[model samples]
Target: NAGVIQTPRHKVTGKGQEATLWCEPISGHSAVFWYRQTIVQGLEFLTYFRNQAPIDDSGMPKERFSAQMPNQSHSTLKIQSTQPQDSAVYLCASSLQGGSNERLFFGHGTKLSVL
Candidate 1:
């Protein structure tokens, strides 16, 4: 069975520290995937990938937040100067293809906690 895999099921970082989250999409699936879930904002799209390229990141904060898909097997989300407001369940998902119509396979998520 293959599925998206996110590392560090839980992470704790200090308010000015940095947090790097990893996500390994199913072996064969493609298209960019990253989302953040919080009690106040619910589920929000952070970025989208297609053919290992970032195509959209409008939902991400202009500063301190970035995502990248270096290859077909994995992707990453890094947050700089982490703040308490940055804490959330960072979800990684992939679709059979890149688009809104395709089904998404999501990892359990990496819960980030900032102090």
Candidate 2:
């Protein structure tokens, strides 16, 4: 079975443009997670969902970043008015169980570049 599927492995956008990232979790997984990686912030958990229901989004920036799990198979992360600082590797992970202590399988991640 596939671990996770992330489309448009690499994306480039203008500083003010909007960017959308996609993820397909493994079948049978109950939880999905999103994270951002940058030089300054090694790995920052952005948001997550369990059984297609949003769980936590405290890590997301109130202004331009948002994530949604509309269904079981897929999830989306959107960044509006993109800035250079938004450039980073956006990772998606999923697990059979969700909590502070659970093993998660991650995707290759979508690398976003804001110019």
Candidate 3:
């Protein structure tokens, strides 16, 4: 089926290390978004891109979060100097470059654990 693909379903990292996650979107979609969800903070919009260009990132935290969509079919989220506060389910969703936010299809998520 054509859907978003996220890897490592789970990740364990040290408090001050780097964590890199991968994603593959549906074949022709051009908009991608990254969202972070946690029991304590609910769902937060991290960032989004359209046609390989970032469209909005007003919800991303200021510390160490970054996202990139190098091509039309894939993207990645990288966390530098991870912290316990950063532990959460990282999700990637995609849709057509403009218009209605298509029914976002999510991956199984990459649950991160910082210790």
Cα lDDT tens digits, model 3, 9-90, are 9999999999999999877888888889899888888998888999998888767888888888789898999999889999
Predicted candidate 1 versus true structure: per-residue lDDT over 1-115, tens digit per residue? 6688999999999999999999998877878589999999999999988889888899999999988888898899999999999999999998877867888989999999999
TM-score of each: 0.96, 0.96, 0.93
Q: Write the per-residue lDDT of candidate 2 for residues 1-108, one digit (tens) a residue.
A: 978999879999999999999999999898999999998989999998999888889899999998999889999999999999999999999998796788999999
Task: Judge candidate 3 at residue 34 and give its lDDT.
Answer: 88
Write down the worst ten-residue block by lDDT for model 2: 95-104
* Candidate 2's TM-score: 0.96
Q: Comparing 2 and 3 by lDDT, which wins?
A: 2
Output the number of the lDDT-best candidate.
2
Q: Which 10-residue window in model 1 sums to the lowest lDDT? A: 24-33
RMSD of 3: 1.2
Record all residue pairs in model 3 with backbone atoms less than 3 Å apart, i.e. clashing.
Answer: none
Tell me which of candidates 1 and 2 scores higher on lDDT. Answer: 2
Task: Give candidate 1 misplaced runs (Cα > 4 Å).
Answer: none
Report the Cα lDDT for candidate 3: 0.86
